[model samples]
Target: MRGVDVLSTAFKNAFRSRLRTSLTVLAIFIGAFTLSLTNGLGTGINQYIDDTVASVGVDDVMTVTKASEEEPTDGPAEYDPNQIAADGAPGATATALTDDDIDTIAGIDGVESVEPSKSVMVDYVRHDDGTRYQLSVAEFVPGMRIELVSGEQVDLDASDPELVLPESYVEPLDLGSAADAVGQTVVLAVTDATGEQVTTEATVVGVAEPGVLTMGGAVPNDVLAAELYDLQTTGAPEAETTRYAEASVSFDTSGGATQTEALQDRLADAGFTGSTLEDQLGTITAVIDGIVLVLNGFAVIALVAAGIGIVNTLFMAVQERTREVGLMKAMGLSSGRVFSLFSIEAVVIGLVGSALGVLGAVGAGQLVNGVSGDLLADLPGLTLIAFDPVGVATVVLGVMAIAFLAGTLPALRAARQDPISSLRYE
Candidate 1:
């Protein structure tokens, strides 16, 4: 038979044994649906992480700290009575970075520069006719911008003493809403280095929404940071004034991954450790990816079981069609055409099963999202099962390939049957 004729005959023949073929197709459908749903789950979660990562921190910048110098000893090392600390610097007990450490970091090759993290020691924060509350303030780091509820973000490069208030702080400060809080000034009281109380004021330029990677507190412009740092250290001797909690390290990544790793390696060897934002989220992503992989394993086992079903059904079809195969051969049909005909039947089953499974999965995904969306209202931008067209197409093609492989043995058996022996048997 011609190829088209063989395909046409195969299509018609597939449904001749409706019950058996339907059972096999149903088996394949279950496997495909499971596999596609699992894939979509992975895709949705990873995509959400990627979106969060954009606000997590700057990819080119890494947080750095001095490697701890004290090694564990059986007993406390010989005390150095002469080990003196700068008069106003951080206490020896604290892991305080100093100007010298910053200088050392800047000296490293491939290092751009370092910005020391300024700790804003606020005694109390109070808004117009509102109760005073203790609050923590953080400087606006480049690339780690928070999602805005209203107004605009703090311009880190600008010298204005602008602050982005957190949503949680809105009601406490008597700010009715994000829009109402904008352009309002709040008073911040702190104890300067001279042990005297100092009060500073900053304008509320914006309000921030909650985010996974944000500080969850007030974000201040560079001017506020500089202002607070000066007040906290003013009148203290320079030797005691310049201390840092940690520092932001910037490096050139134009050298690509290899050079970026090399730079980090060099920093490590120099007694300083640096970690990019990805490093911070590495463990989280690893755990998520591992769970997704385990779920996918179960889906694949189902697909494998479906393949066996395909094999059994094709074998049964080959037996039932033996007389028909003999008759076709007797009419001058080539063995290759007979093989093609059986293979096409398997392909047809795969196509029907995959189409049903994929369409069903899409509908089920919508139902799951609708049911769970309100239950997970806090987790915005999350779709538990989300499909990618390419991923869905890949699953379909993979199932069809498995079906084609399963039918190979049956096709070969049908092609090898002797015409005279097969015709006389029945």
Candidate 2:
């Protein structure tokens, strides 16, 4: 028989018992459905995380902090003046970053520059409507990620006090929308030496969207940072004023990921630890990936069960068609063609099952995502289950490959049947 004839015969033979074929296909469908859904879930979440991380962190710069050497005691030790202290946070056992540390960090190989972090204390910040809210500021260091809902990033070099507002603050600040908030003047209040509230005005430069990695805090320009530092420490002594919380170290990007990691390793060797945005969020990503992996493993288990179904189904088909196999071989059909015919039947079953399963998964995923939209409204641009064409195709091909492997033993048995004995059997 010709190749086309063999294929056509195999396809017809696949549905010789419609109910039997349907049951086997259903088994494959369950596995494919689970696999596609899990893959889509993983893709959607990881893609969102990648986008947010890119928006909020710089790859080439590392945030450096002093390493805490554990002075193990019988229990928690009381305030000892011998060790360094965190300046902004009271009673925190943090080693304050000094000028010498900056010099040494700057002297490290591959380091381009070092910017010391200064903690600003603003008593309160309010819009023109005089509604005051609690104040906190984040620094705009190299590689820091920020996405503006409207307006531009903070002008760090601007001589005047420029501030970026988080989206959550736009409404509370009595600013109607993010767009209208830009270019408006906001008043920041601080306590003076006499413990009186001193008000200062700053221009609103941008409105930023909150992200998983981006803290929902405002960013003040260098001018504002210095001003807030001065206002907060005006009454405090010089010893307290000289201390810094941490510093940012910028490294050359010419070398790539390995080089950047090496620089961080070198920093650790010097009694300091450096972390990029990826390093900071590594644990979070790892957890997400781990959950996805566990879910995928379950899907794979379903697939393995489906593979066994393929094996059993093909084995039974071969048994029922023994006489037909003998007759075809008697009619000059080669063993190779017989084997190809059975394998093609297996392929058709896989194709039908995988196609239906993918359609089902996509429909279910869409329904879930649609219902979840309102619940996840706070997290904009998030698609709960998103299917990638390449990933989908991979899933389909993967199932088909498994089916082919499962059909091998049965296909070989059918190919090796004896024509004289098989034709004489009842």
Candidate 3:
């Protein structure tokens, strides 16, 4: 029989056995749907990570201090920085990062700029009700220009006392707006080098952009410093500063991979430890990818089960058509023609089932997203699920291959049937 004729006959027979054909198609549909959902989720996670990294400006590298050197002791040693500082003792022999370190980092190859910062814990007085809040004072060095929504960036050269606060703090205190908070004076109490509580008044200067505070627990670093320093008669003495933070070097480069590797090497050479946004994002992406892979494996098993069902159904069809096959052979139909006819039916079943599966998955994805939107509305950096066409196409092709293999044994058996013996058996 011609290929088209064979396909037509196979489809006709498939519809004639409606119940079995429907069950077989349903099996394929379940397998395809599962595979597509997992694949689409994986893609969505990757895209979300990429978006977060891009929004945060991954070209910059950050450096933070590691634990201090300590002599070997018998019992488990406490390593908390807060506890050590509370004990009125310096925990580490390693020197705090200084202007010299910043200069050295800036001199490195591919280094575009460097910013040094220092943070100290202090007490803040709420302007409206005079409630106390623990705050960290941060100093911003020159060349680190953060995007500001209101007012101006910290003036590294100006000795005038100024402070900035995060927008998050404004709403909790019933501070009407960030713009109103600007130019208002707030008092900050800080412990001096001699452990004396000194209060300083600083004028609010500006508000940082929302993106700056989205990832890490960031605040107005320079503003807090100005507040604490202005309150004290003798501002925080440099020698007594406990913790120092720095943005040692930032590059004007692109491509997260190359920049991360180069920055890691530079940090290691400078006796510091740090991580880039790309590294953190990569860790998250790897975990999501592993989960997707495990789920896909389960989906593959489901598809295998469906394939077996297809084989069984085709075998039953062959048995029921034994006399018919024998008659066709007697009428000069070739074995190759019989095989082609059976294969065509399997392909058609697979294609139709895959189409249904794709439609179902897409609809389900949309429904899930709609329900999740309300729950995720308040979550920062949350991403919605989406469908991927490339993944759908891959799943369809895989299903078709499995279906064709399932039909192969039955087709071969029917092709080898003997006309004269078969006619006599029944």
Candidate 4:
């Protein structure tokens, strides 16, 4: 048969045995569906992470801390007065980052600038005659951003103290809605270094929507954070007050991951640990990727099982068409043409099944994404399942390739038939 005739005959022949072909197609469909869905899951989650990275403005920022000098051992070492315990970790000690450390980080190659981070604690927050509620303030870095439901991010250069309230606090603080919370004034109570309570008033510049980076707390402008830090250290020694737990370092990453890694390595050699936002969130992405890989493994197994079905179905078709094959060979068709016919038929089956599976997966993914979008409204900008065109195409092509490979043995058997012997036997 010629090209068009071969293809037309192959397609017509593929479904001659309706029940058997349908079973084979169904098998391929299951594998294709599973593979597409898992790929979409990975794509969706990673896309969300990328969006968060862009939205939060932490793409080129790295958090740096003084490396601990204490060696690891089975037993705890003697306490050192100079080492300070991190907040929330009662007994864990960390080397403090001092002015010299900040200066050292600033002097490193590729470093744009450095800002020391300050830990500020607030006893309670009260608005007007509302009852006091405990609160925590997050340090505001220069390039960091907060997703706001109302108003704008805190104005770092503004002379007066300013802060952004978490959306959760609006109702309990009697601040009405997120919109109403903006421009309101609130009192923050804190204890000074002298062991005395100090209260400060700060304007609410914005109300932030909940986000992974925000850590479910109020965000403060540099001015407000400095004010709080100063108040907390009122009676403390100047040297002690300058020590910090960590610092934010801005770096040039135009050369990409390699350059970033080199900078981190340099920082490590300088007795500091530097981690980019991606580095901090790597564990989460790694876990997600691993889960996707595992799910894909199941899909691959299904595809392999489907390949066996293709093999069996084609083998039966070859047997049933033996007389037809003998007649075609007598009518001037070559063994290669017979092989091509069977292989093309297998491909046709694969195309039908994979196409159906891809379409079904896309439809199902959209439904799931819609339901999840509504259910996870708080986590804005997230799509639980998103399909990539390339990935979908890859799945379809992959299934078809498996089908072609599985039909090889059947095609070979049909090609090897002796025209005279096959015609004489039934």
**Top lDDT: which candidate number?**
4
Query: Which stretch of 10 consecutive residues in model 1 shows the poorest summed lDDT?
Result: 80-89
Q: Which is superior by lDDT, 2 or 4? A: 4
The digit string of per-residue lDDT tens for model 2 on 1-426 reads 788998898899889978988998999899899999998988888788777777664777788888776665798776644355553457666776778888988998988999888777677789875678997676667555467899888776789998888888888889888999999999988886557777788989999887654467788888888787788778776666666667888888789888998898899998788988787667667888798889888988998898888888989999998898999899998999989889888887887888889989999999989987888876777888889999899989998998898888889989999998889868
On lDDT, who's better, 3 or 4?
Answer: 4
lDDT per residue for candidate 4 within 241-293, as digits (tens), equals: 98998899998879899999999999999999998888877867888999999
Scored by Cα lDDT, where does model 2 land? 0.83
Tens-place lDDT digits, model 1, residues 1-426 = 677888889998888999999998998899889888888888877777777886554688877776656675799665633233321347443345778888988898988978887777788889984799887775456666778889888887777688888878888999888899999999988888889988899999989886555456788888888898889888888765677656888888788788878888988898777777777677667878798889878987988788888789988998988888999999999999988888888878887787788888889999988977888655667787889999899989988888888888899999998998878766
| After superposition, candidate 4 runs with Cα above 4 Å error | 67-95, 121-123, 190-198, 231-243, 253-262, 281-283, 424-426
**How high is the lDDT of residue 198 in model 3?**
74
State the C-alpha lDDT per candidate: 0.81, 0.83, 0.67, 0.89
| Clash pairs for candidate 3 | 163-223, 199-231, 200-231
All candidates: TM-score: 0.77, 0.82, 0.72, 0.88
Error of 4 at 96 (Å): 4.0
Candidate closer to the true structure by lDDT (higher is better), 1 or 3:
1
Candidate 1's displacement at residue 101, Å, is 3.9
Ranking by lDDT: 4, 2, 1, 3
Better candidate number, 3 or 4, judged by TM-score? 4
